[model samples]
Target: MQNSTCHLQPSLATSVALPVIYSLLFPAGSFGNILAAWIFLKQAPTKRTQYIYLGNLVAANLCVCSTMPFLAVYFARGYQWTYVSTECKITNHLGTLNMHVSMYVTIIILCSTAINQYATLKKTSDTQYSQAINENFYRCVLKKFRQPKFAKQLSTIIWLTVLCITVIAIIYNAKEEIEKDSKCYSIGAEANETTAGIAAFVGTACFFLSFTTVLLSYYCLTKHLSKIQKTTCIGEKHLIYSTVKRNILVIQMILTVCFLPYHIFRPIFYVLLTDRYCLRLNYLVEIKNFLTCLAAAKSSLDPIIILMLDKTFKKSLYGLFTKSTPENHQCKADIFTEETSKM
Candidate 1:
């Protein structure tokens, strides 16, 4: 099976559309991630460890975006990869790595934030049940893991673990034989049914895990916030409540827009392709390709989300673009610094 070749031809419309989409995404994603990186770097020293994870997320997005031009050219050339086999392998590997990294990192950020918020709320609760066994259990669990240092360590561990698993997959795929006449265009062509099946299984697991984590985190957060609102006067903490709500909403939007479609479609696409059912459903291939491109576009879209949701980032961006007096610039910088410090 590893010696066999799989020739999957994308539809003409899809072939044309993919390159155009990739072409547009390349510059937009690159610019946004670069700007995000610059902002994160400037604020890194004063920022919490959450910013460390965010900085890593921006870096991963940049890595994903960097491969877009090559993909564009590949699709533009009628699904033919003009590059050497090694380059083809590297490009494919990078895409897979970035996909997993981006999804998992986003999960980590959301889960950590949810946990911290829950811990903070619980610690300040005046309810009689605050001293109950369940409350103590949560306090103990959260106390063990809820710290900036722990977040930093977890981020490092996630990066290393993802790198290791992806590297193994890359090596396995690289060992597969390629036909001399075939272009390195179809990812399914690089591996056999067994490998593709395993990949599909892993992807399915990841999708469920990520989706469930995000959903539960947001649900718990919303529930907790509702309780707080019921107990406390809305006018007293309106700014903080609104800001937190906006951030959560932005996260849900990002998860829905950028990640959800790909996660939902990818496993099905892979299963069909591996089982040879996709030949009868050629449109699925096109949809899969479109989802792949869309997933990559998420990295680009994230910075825009951050800019819209984060006042500090928005202010810094505005100050950068607009001509301002040194005094005004200094004031904005101070504000930015203060905001990041609180983050």
Candidate 2:
């Protein structure tokens, strides 16, 4: 006879573990995201094209974090949800929507940054091939595509597309009945095999697409930087190289730590569950849950990443946190002046 404890152990561990994790995540994520939003709003005048995408990213993370407390409550009660079915469906839908939005927006920002860097490097270099390309190409392609207005338009399009898909998901999930004492779970009850499989496939596809784009962007940027290092003076090379490298490092860190693990495991778990192979693969299920938690942690980590990477955001955040004085106020003005000069 199979031991019932063996059958129940994973659920027991999940029920005990996730609530504790979510509890810590909720406050931390909330504070970080709120601060990010506030800083971005205050500094919107000085914002560049990437900052628009980043602001949207912050909003997406904030939306995701807002739902975490409810998730913690659901997990804390041994996966049983006393909330209405509508609430459960909305929470689940919002989570999915924001995940996609965050990944896509990050990819957009990386691509934009890569293109700008490449253009700058090519223009400054003495390479014959780069100069052979006419001004028309630069004006029609790079300049047109990389404009700040285009980024705002792209942001609008992304939100609209996400909203359309989320509405579809919400409607699809709403058809199912939630039993009176049902557990508000992601897999077994809320989503059945077909829905879960579709979700996993979509998630896997998005992950690959975004991951490939980001990888290629960073590769090209690195290659360009290497060429620049060889050609440019050492004094000028260090500052530019360090800045690009830091940005690339932060992007790669977010992808590896938050997004990669979840996408890798999510599809496997769903396919196994759909085929009724999950009984023998309980360990993978636990791993998938852990990855999901990591994905959620991205909301908290993103604000810190912004502060680390953006001088303006860091200065603004520092000003907000520290005591105000004439010297500090003057320092802030100086930073703003320096940033404007760069633009």
Which candidate number would show the highest TM-score if scored against the true structure?
Answer: 1
* Tens-digit lDDT string for candidate 2 (1-343): 1111222234765677887887898899889989889887885443465567678778877766876776565555534443256555555555444554554555445455545444444433434564445456653454443457876887788778767776776686677564455445534443356666686687678767766766765786678777767786647546655675567666766777788878877766655654434455556656766777787888777888788888888888878878989998788778777654343
Candidate 2 stretches with Cα past 4 Å from truth are: 1-10, 81-87, 90-145, 177-183, 274-278, 322-334, 340-343
CA displacement after TM-score superposition, residue 20 of candidate 2 (Å): 1.3
RMSD of 2: 4.5
By summed lDDT, which 10 consecutive residues of candidate 1 come out lowest?
117-126
Using all chains and alpha carbons, the TM-scores for the candidates as numbered come to 0.82, 0.80
